[model samples]
Target chain A: MQYDFEEILETIKMTEIEHFDIRTVTLGISLRDCVDRNIEVTKQKIYDKILKYGKNHVKYASQIERQYGIKIANKRVSITPASIPFDSFKLDEFVEVARVLDKAAAEIGIDYLAGYSALVQKGMTNGERELIKSIPIALSETQRVCSSINVASTKAGINMDAVLMMSDVIKETAERTKDKDSIGCAKLVVFCNVPEDNPFVAGAFHGVSEPEVVLNVGISGPGVVLDAIKSAGKIDLQQLAEVIKKTVFKITRAGELIGREVASKHGIPFGIVDISLAPTPAPGDSIGDILKAMGVEDVGAPGTTAALAMLNDSVKKAGLMASSSVGGMSGAFIPVSEDQAMIDAVERGNLSLEKLEAMTSVCSVGLDMIAIPGDTPSTTIAGIIADECAIGIINDKTTSARLIPAYGKKLGDYIDYGGLLGKAPIMDVRNLSSNNFVGRGGRIPAPVRSLTN
Target chain B: MFISYFGKLKGKKVKLSESEIRAIAMQAINELGDNANPELVKEVVEKAIKNSEYVPIPETQSQTTGRVILTSFGLNHPGIVSNVTKVLSDANCDITDLSQKLMGDFYTMIIMLDISNSPKDLSEIQNDLNVVAEKMKIKVYLQHEDLFRFMHRV
Candidate 1:
């Protein structure tokens, strides 16, 4: 036999019992050429382009899934940032684009279509300003359109003006969709140094430099990593890291193969395989569970950051060795709602907002899928976004805030969207005011680290 | 022939046989006539290659033998192997290897099959096996060999 019996059994066990699966196979279609002078013509072009390239996205993904017997969780799409091509549009016109995106997503049979976005890391254009203003209405009105705003980067510094506007946008999005526990906020992400090739939704966008169409994948297998760690009980940190790397390497290889296969099926170029160990709401598929298995008492324990740093590092090292096309946010995601154990920690008071922020410093993204009190002021939200941006710029890594201020919901309450978004306990946010600091709207000059040249 | 010739030329390390190069040169001469300088011959050859239909290699064709691992398990009972193999035989699948283990009334069997020659695809075969599994009260899984090879073999 070419493969050992135990090896075959292990592969089967990972898929069947360990919750190992490809998190998403996101098809990135560029809409740069879809722009037109007339809003109606532009909408038609956008719709036609998406349908032409993406009509078979779900069908092809399912066929590949059946052939490999590995489940692909989500078949989604990302487009070029709307502000880039449709920069001449007004606020209402941008909302119309979002509606078309939502309709195309439904027609193509996908749950989410991202890249209803603006990249204002350095500054904003009049169109970008209008697009940012339209996000709340676009999100409130559409079902599948996910929006993101990039407000900071290492080279361009933090766009405090964009950050403040996004803060208000998040608040308004929550308020407008209050009927559904502010679910609109769940689909909005505020990013710092956002990856152009990120396959993960609520933050994914087809970078300007990308080809006309591409397929990027996000791999998820925290359950597999957790099992490997539990089985390697009593080992030293070095050996434990080896276990994680081995597990992550195999999964990354599998992920790359699946990504290539899906792209080949689409007859488009294969982008990158993001090795982020994105957690789901399932029981064993929690990054927090992996952290606990690594000897943390809970997610907020003193040694939690060290454990996460080691795990995130091992994942990247293994992923680099496994595949050369690794891009996107290739680290462990600590979203409060998506991971069951993380949610439990928040509900039990073992995990707090501050600890999560600290964890984000070493991980892929920041303050993800967290539900806070409705009355948490926009200035405080801006303060939170600024803090996350500071960490990202200083470290020169990608960070984001997907803070959902569930309208009228306070601490001790829960915002349960169920399914993949899962549920998050309304975390406590300090009442400290940042009205004076964020009130001064200007770009934070690029940090000294940005002077790499 | 023209595509392979053009592909080799594009690499700029021409390893064509004498006859092949002569054929290309003759064609270039025929096309360029009195204008057949080195650069003109090159341009004519390039245009001919571009105009020819270039068929891309089919990506779905597996580089390795199209083998699949089918694993089935259930309470130990008679006729499980016979019934399952019946489906494979019906699909014209070649069972290359088989192993079975019984651990106190529970039976697990792993079968290696070459399905490249089968008329039905993997999904169709799975659907057939699923019916047998449901009737016999067992669990069966069919997965491509590449998945195992990629994960376990470096």
Candidate 2:
């Protein structure tokens, strides 16, 4: 007997009681080499590389999951940002590349393929402008392809121009996929301080600096932490934080072990283990529930921010201790549609869009999975991205938005996507216009904090 | 017949229930790992009566928590249950309930474990058991009780 019985049981308890799982095992490949002047050659090269890696990664990930009895929610792929490698392509030509990525992803038998992306924190290059412009068509035309754009960062100021443009792109994407609850918007994330090695999509991409190929993991277990908090029974905040910190260590250790094993078996270098408290729509598997367990009466209440900050910092501390290669957005994710508690709170009118924005300042992301009225001004959407990106830049944290403008749907209407993506109610937005704020189409200078370097 | 777990080199042997004898022996082997000295192990096994965990409690399981069924098959040898339970217990899995069979040279075991209080994780325990199973030439598999019910239910 190498291990005690109790340790084995705790792991089982997490999955059984709380619906704990490895959210994603994304294998990132540098598509930089897939670049070619000829579009056909480029598309073929990308397809071949993706198919080759996809087969092995998925096979090995499923094997690991079966062998260890840990459920993996998704096996995904992230490639080098398309804007860089296919920089010479026309605006519409980039859509063909996206089609190739989508087909390759499906052929590889993966859930999603990310990196239909661009980095325009400071400015957009000619190819990046083409990529950004092609985003709507690419997203609307491809089922498994996810798109992301980094419009702000700590070192780079927020690109209000890109922010404004994405608002329109998102609008078109929503309209194009209106039949499926504007699902195209669901696959697009506007990011500030995006991670290169993120295993989670709609925001995953192999950054310019990543290796030729690597494996990254995203570990999620909000239910396990909530159970511990419940067992602690009205403990003080300090004690609750301590409890979260300890539990996170076990989860992160499990994640690192799984990630390293998969990487070792596939002969790909291990990237990072992102131990985030990402919630699904499942009952009892909610961070909002954890907030309640921590004595916050409502998820979006006054104390919610403090509770989230504690949870986020505690996870990071535990993850840092558990794995030296911790990266990506490793904190509590407050995606509205994906979390049942959040959806309930919003539908019940207790969680307002304003409160959600405030909460996102402390979370790993900003205003994620939120659905707004179809007629809400794209300027307002731009304003939201700008504000969220400003928070990321000034506070030096990762923040993103995956907002859906439910076409022809307004406040109080609900749309369900079933399973993991879950359901979201159309949230009301401030009626007043932010056209002037968004009109200032220039870099919102890097914050003073950026001068630390 | 239960082994005398409290018997030393020069002391009157004290009888221990079957569960007590098994718990202490497993505990010693679990701690010593592969470096365990046979004579020292026997001596510690006899002196393990002082351990509170060695004191058997009435079979009671909390109704709120469910269990997992752990199965192992191997060439028949001594201490199959002892060795398996030792590793599981050391991993903090509670051996609340168990059943075993030895037919010919093949041994089979099924253990009901409540993992709610485990200090380590399931994957780590699996890896450890895998190492031990390979060394002892056994095949081990685990499934949640609900999964077993769904699979075999009419």
Candidate 3:
């Protein structure tokens, strides 16, 4: 029992990586207890919960990072869906609750406030309907309140009716405020049984099972893994795993250092770290490189999905072993505009919405950062989003739609999101109509198995 | 004022930049000793950057956030602290904080901070760090604070 822990610290200090650091240590706090008989009381409860929980999180996360010599990328909070508590309340109450949540998030130095959401995928709860009704106004008025509605699911099959409602909702939300569309896009999302622990926004919300002030970290290193695969060519799957495992292990360590330090600094209990292959439209860091390293000529080639499945699994396997706690939709993302490889693939006719959808089956989420014809009908757009949601709900993973209807683009035309979002070519979808199917408004009922078991 | 070359490889035609052709020429002269042509080198670099990332992964990862965590066993071994810190110090991972404690047979440590000029992955560096840990007979783990929080939670 000769302990030399400080010596280990010296070793880590010797060879630090460059600017790479943990992006976010989000605290997912369930606010179910905040429900109340009076609207004013409920608002206060929401405010109090966020202020107290958020205040301690950043401080704690910072403390841990300081000890381990890592950086915490961001501090944010996600709460229970607003639909549950504001279900019976009026639009004014919804607005009031949103204001309080925004103020709390700001006070605690939290950058993102998620969970100002409603779910209307299968059937509209009275609360769900009201939340949806207020989305356009809430997003226009509130500073930090982001909202999402579960528009469709695969469990009970696609809710075409919900899709139609959501279609109008998006259109109206977009049109309601000219200057706030970015905020609109930032605030609103359409999901399919989205994960409860997602650290990314405009969809993060406290799930029923999450504890108050529980922290979750998101790790990104497509650049590192891509480079490793590049150097280790034509190797066996095991060899590939070895290279990736080594890379992921190191990246996860950096993330863990940040998370633990932040937790200690804030004095709250440390939570799980998520190892997601997050990508941006930056020049060189794309998950597409993994596919390229696997010998794909272009990212969306025929074998793309299979390649992604292997990459995603390999990443998870290595990440899960590195740390005891792992949460969030920890998978490789295929956001077309957010990855340079994907953007090039789209531009060069090697990628498409259909191809992206096919790839999503083996990955997480669908049609992210995809641009479509602006004239694309609301029903058709909803149908597309619904199809993506169906994939998530049936599979029981988080799925989201971030389709951007480029203001004046047509199929084959290109729109640039400038920075991080990159640029994308508009993709085509089937011209057939789903208007009739989407017109019906009612729950399709939960999947049969969920009810029985 | 520079010459450009066009070539076909893998059934795709590419227009090579003049500078690219020169680099190719330079490399060819070094390795192939004039046997390598300017056109060939341009193709190689263009293909290399396109088929793979030009920047190393660890270098790219280092750009976002540099958060860390430190765990220490105890203070029994008087010279242990200096020895433990050498590894991270050598790798350029900035020591943000140091948490050390002494248990019966093991001294525990947890450190948190951003790594400055760290290689692509922390785990890759761990083996090197482990060499120091092994010499001291102590177990060591390196992690990003974000990732560390994720791994430890129930």
Best by TM-score: 1
lDDT of 2 by residue, A22-64 (tens): 8999999999988888889999999999887777778888767
Predictions in order: lDDT: 0.92, 0.83, 0.68
The residue-by-residue lDDT of candidate 2 on B1-154, one tens digit each, is 6544434434444557787767777888787888789887876775676544343332222122436668677789876677778898897898877766678988766687877688865556777788878877887766545433321221
Q: Count the backbone clashes (under 3 Å) in each candidate.
A: 0, 23, 144
Winner of 1 and 2 under TM-score: 1
lDDT of 3 by residue, B1-154 (tens): 4332323344344445566556655655676565567776656556553663222222112223656454544336666778777777777777766665556756666766676567634555666767866776665666545443333332
TM-score of 2: 0.77
In CAPRI terms, model 3 is classed as incorrect
| Candidate 1 per-residue C-alpha lDDT over B1-154 given as tens digits, one digit per residue, 9 for 90 to 100 | 3322335445432234455556667888788788768778778766654554444343344224669999888798899999999999999999999988898999988999999899998999999999999999998999988898888887
Interface RMSD, every prediction, one decimal place: 1.7, 14.5, 11.1
Q: What is the lDDT for A174 in model 2?
A: 91
TM-scores, each model vs. reference = 0.91, 0.77, 0.68
Error of 1 at A253 (Å): 1.0
lDDT of 3: 0.68
Please give the ranking of all candidate structures by TM-score, highest first, separated by commas.
1, 2, 3
lDDT of 2: 0.83
Best by lDDT: 1
Q: What does the lDDT come to for candidate 1?
A: 0.92
DockQ of each: 0.45, 0.02, 0.07
Top candidate, metric DockQ: 1
